[model samples]
Target: MKNILQVVHFPQGAVEDIRFIKSTNMPYAATGDLFISCNTSDIDANNGGYLIARLDKNFLNGIPTSLSWFNVVWAKGYAKAVHPWDVTNQGEVYYVSGESHGYDWSAMYCLNSQGKRRPVSNWRTHWLKNGTEWKGTPASANPFGQIDSVNYSGIVFKITGRCELRSWNMADFSSVQSDGNGGTRKGKWPADFLFNSPCDPQNPSANSPGYTGYSPEACCPVWGLAVLQLIEGIIMYTWE
Candidate 1:
């Protein structure tokens, strides 16, 4: 039989080459049950771009398959590019870009069996900030830009059906100023008391030493998941 295959093009560009492919030996035991991640770039632009494709065995035989593409646009006067990471059987993929706009960060997403993309909450909106000086050796100076200087602050938003979009402020954080009206900041604070710090033990002057500014509680949902798991474990152990 003649080989018949389908091809699709992304608005940004087309898939250039297949970089790597791996099959799982444990979770699922099937030949075509494989994960493929590749690179796609703008042919005309010639800077750097990336896309990902997860193919089953049938796809290798020329069947049409859905692919996910991510493109990075460089800011004015900035030369940069984005790169894609390897794919995992758990339907998760990650991408990083830095050459664009003189800064860079990584994004993680979960792919459904149908190839639909879903954002991973914990890894979402995570900027590649410089590791704390106490953590380890000082990281090499980021060529694109510093994470804090490039606005690493993020906001967590809930979407329908437990989905969410975590977005980070892409503007330069170094220059961000508090809204003159402190009472209206978007945190768990009363409108009447915006200038004071609830967590401040010393009650330092506004913007003064010992005055840790308004810090909203971490919106991490992992704690809730852990509690639920603990309860389940206790019940199971008690039955034993």
Candidate 2:
């Protein structure tokens, strides 16, 4: 594997995780590029933020052509999802959970190419137990269930140690269900949803770079069965 990009922050910068965004509808970054979720030198002023590493075919020495940085106004750390939404007046949305920074809440945030940030509350989240509305999971109550961690593509999957694979409909942030025929149809949250083991649900996966244990697969439900089968095969072989 070749190192395609490298980010260096002087004095104090901790690179947490990295994601690649495909072509999007955003004006500033219309092409595909790389993004990073990391802690800058100043946490209070540059805490929960991400770096846009514009990839260039000609920029030499494995470096990004340019970098644009933005931080979530109130996020301390541990942010995920930098997906581009066609709506939102030309902006991208991301989710930040307090789980990493020692807070018990998760939320979706939006950012424009101009570095403007805002907390969004457009989710129809009665799917949560207490039926909390957006601006995120209710502070301290987390009606949806404890989110050990979350992964996002077009939809967000909340993975927990309880052997759960809860999904949130991103199309409208409403409730959704598998049609029992491998397709998704409208359904209420908690109800109409299927429950199954996403991993050794007993072994909650950690995303740390140095972590070297059983990592649960973070895949869309469309291929969930295949991933589960592969993981089970690994587990069974290891046990044998």
Best by TM-score: 2
Predicted model with the maximum lDDT:
2
Regions more than 4 Å wrong, model 1: 1-14, 24-29, 43-48, 56-84, 97-101, 104-106, 124-240
Question: Each model's TM-score?
Answer: 0.32, 0.33
Model 2 ranges with Cα > 4 A deviation? 1-34, 39-66, 72-91, 100-103, 119-121, 124-178, 182-187, 190-240
Compose the digit string of candidate 2's lDDT tens values, residues 91-208: 3533332223232333333444554433223322223334333223332223434432211111122433222232233342244557679977543333212332122322543231
lDDT of each: 0.31, 0.32
Cα deviation in Å at residue 96, candidate 1? Answer: 3.2
The 10-residue segment of model 1 with minimum total lDDT is 223-232
Tell me the lDDT of model 1 at 232.
Answer: 15
Write out the backbone clash pairs for model 1: 32-57, 80-99
